[model samples]
Target: MFHRYLNKVAVVTGGSKGIGRGIVKVFVENGAKVVFCARGAAEGEALQAELNQSAAGSCSFLSCDVSQEEDIKRLIAHTVTLHGHIDCLVNNAGWHPPHKATDDTTADEFRDLLNLNLVSYFLASKYALPYLRQRHGNIINISSLVGTIGQKDAATYVATKGAILSMTKAMAVDESRYYVRVNSISPGNVMSPLWLDLAAQTGAAAEAIKAGESNQLMGRMGTEDECGLAALYLASEATFCTGVDLLLSGGAELNYGFKSQICS
Candidate 1:
């Protein structure tokens, strides 16, 4: 699959860990030179070394806070300087401070969610437009099932992802003239480090993972590799595909009330 991407240059935000890391790994294995950014310099640096050593793909890390416009600009600029041009952009960096009721969510938290998840995606796409147009590249945004279905106690996070879906469509339509396709991937519960951390923090790790798995028709959460494959399909194979939200939620969508059954 990656043999098709040899020598191509790609940018993936929030690439330090979790699904973002998986996406980076897939791209590099496919022969793409990658520039991945995250705010955690230590983690990013370590991952860069590991990737360089193990994968045949060339990778570099940038410690850029995606919430800031200047930082995003620097990330894109740095990628151009190192790789000469950008062939693909993956907006995968994002965070959620657990689902909370509207009354429980602070204004500051809401703003942060929008800044990091929604605005950053816009800024990255805006800055990468030129390079992407040049190569007729593609943009793949990492959204969530919450965006489409909407979730209880997750207003802010859901809103941001919902916006990404809309943005993907709008950008795709506008960029079609330049042959720069834009699409999105909406993943369901997965066993990411973040999910692991959530379990530790809430003492619900085992329970949550167990419930998510049992709820799915496949009897398990989706995998990073699964999302990676979906991303690659959109980024490379879907020439006519634009503005589509590829739902990689296993069969969770099919059995809507299964999750509630666990706690009930």
Candidate 2:
């Protein structure tokens, strides 16, 4: 019912999997040509091939490390050269290191987390503004519920997400004069491949998933597509909305016991 993006060109960072991939799928299904970038060449190529075969939406994958300025510039240049103009930008690429307290986190790890989670968004927006300004496009940043309510043992992640919220607000106000809308979507726990990767690292995937599900009043973690829909709404139909943070946390932020939601 909401295929309003037909013929538009979009750029989605970290679109090879997880929430990013879900957003790409929705945009493509809605008739948008997508240029999605990820560091994984194999997954990127596979997704591109699948989209081409499905005839859902024309798509291409470019390898990019969003933390790097040169790579982000290259990504934007490539997309502009390929698609001519960008109608939307989705900053969905991010990383969450294992739960670690501030005291336990090394200086380097904290910096690395910020670089990946926060700096990437800034870099992407910096390079994408020219094209976005030309089209009066929109930017949708994928934030997190943790940004609103702090999570225990996730100080670095929470800090970065909080910064993202601030950045979205500041940028929205700064870009409104140009008719470009900027916003953010903060999603709660969602089941995605990232969980599997987390499991492989921490050896607590099954237990973690079970605990994550029970924390929500819905007794379930949200789906990636749910988050995607939130992003699509802000990036497309919400023309009157800017500097808004759409929280898709499924009531997880509501008042409750001060306890670890990750291991209910």
Collision pairs in model 1: 2-30
Query: How far off is residue 64 in model 2, in Å?
Result: 1.1
Identify the candidate with maximal lDDT. Answer: 1
| Each candidate: RMSD | 2.3, 2.6
Candidate 2 lDDT trough over 10 residues, lowest sum: 255-264
Residue 170 in candidate 2, Cα distance off native in Å: 0.3
lDDT for residue 41 in candidate 2, whole number 0-100: 94
lDDT of candidate 2 over 1-264, digit per residue (tens): 557678889999999998998888888877789999999899998988888777546889999999888999999999999989998999999998877777888999989989999998999998999899999999999988889988778888899999999999999999998999999999888888886676666787788788788778888988877877787778778989999999887788887666655764
The TM-scores of all predictions, comma-separated, are 0.94, 0.94
**TM value for model 2:** 0.94
Judge candidate 1 against the unseen true structure and give its global Cα lDDT, from 0 to 1.
0.88
